[model samples]
Target: MMIKLLAIGKTDSTHLQELISEYEQRLKHYIKFELDIIPDIKNVKNLSEVQQKEKEGEAILKRLQPTDVLVLLDEHGKQHTSIEFSNYLQKKMNAGIKRMVIVIGGPYGFSEEIYQKAQGKLSLSKMTFSHQMVRLFIVEQIYRAFTILKNEPYHHQ
Candidate 1:
């Protein structure tokens, strides 16, 4: 199955961008992976938190296809170990999912409409991280899950 990562804004940190690129390349060896960056909303100083999320949510929803299975990388979502995550990937593949999309929401998080659209939600950690850093974290985890599935030595118990 194809894996798609949709996120708002750009990665400002050069270090994080490089790492994300590395993981993206590694992921290609095992599966089709694409990172689609939705540009940040302009003139955010005037908009309320709810307004911003609504705009962001609209952009996200517009890009989604009817056949895609969306899963949000949310703070309150289900947390899984490396092995379990790998199994989750395998299960999606076994089920013949055409495209698996994982979204990284804005600083204020996703709107109610976005939440309702997702088929599942996953959490990388209980502790908070920057919205920018979460991009790299999810890409790396996707690579790790694939390696674990293939019995590669990338993940350790």
Candidate 2:
């Protein structure tokens, strides 16, 4: 199955971008993967946090195909160990999911509509992280999951 990571805005740090890109390249060896970025909303200074999320949510929803399974990276979502996450992905591939879209919402998080559309929510950690750093963390975890699946030496217990 194809796995895609959809995020809001660009990573301003070149160092972070380089690391994210490196993981993306590694992921290509295991499955179809893409890092799709939804442009940040304009004039956010005038909009409320909720309003910004609404606009960002609209853009995110627009990029999805009807058959894609949506998963959000939410703080309150389920947390899993590295091996468990690999199994989670294996199940999706076994079930013949055409595509899985994992979303990283804007600074304020997702809107109600976006949350409603999601099939599941996953949390990398209980502590909060910058949206930029989260991008790298998720990508690296995904790569590590694949390595674990293949019994490669990249991941440790």
The whole-model lDDT of each prediction reads: 0.94, 0.95
Residue range 1-157, candidate 1, lDDT tens digits: 9999999999899999999999999988999999999999998899999999999999999989999999999989999998899999999999999999999999999999999999999999999999889999889889999999899988888
The local lDDT score (0 to 100) that residue 109 gets in candidate 1 is 90
Tens digit of per-residue lDDT, candidate 2, span 13-126? 999999999999999999999999988899999999999999999999899999999999999999999999999999999999999999999988899999999999999999
Candidate 1 backbone collisions, by pair: none
Model 1 global lDDT (CA atoms, 0 to 1): 0.94
Error of 2 at 6 (Å): 0.6
For each of the candidates, the C-alpha root-mean-square deviation to the true structure, in angstroms, is 0.7, 0.7
Global CA lDDT computed for model 2: 0.95
Residue runs of model 1 more than 4 Å from their true location after superposition: none
Clashing pairs in 2: none
Q: After superposition, how far is residue 108 of candidate 1 from its true place, in Å?
A: 0.7
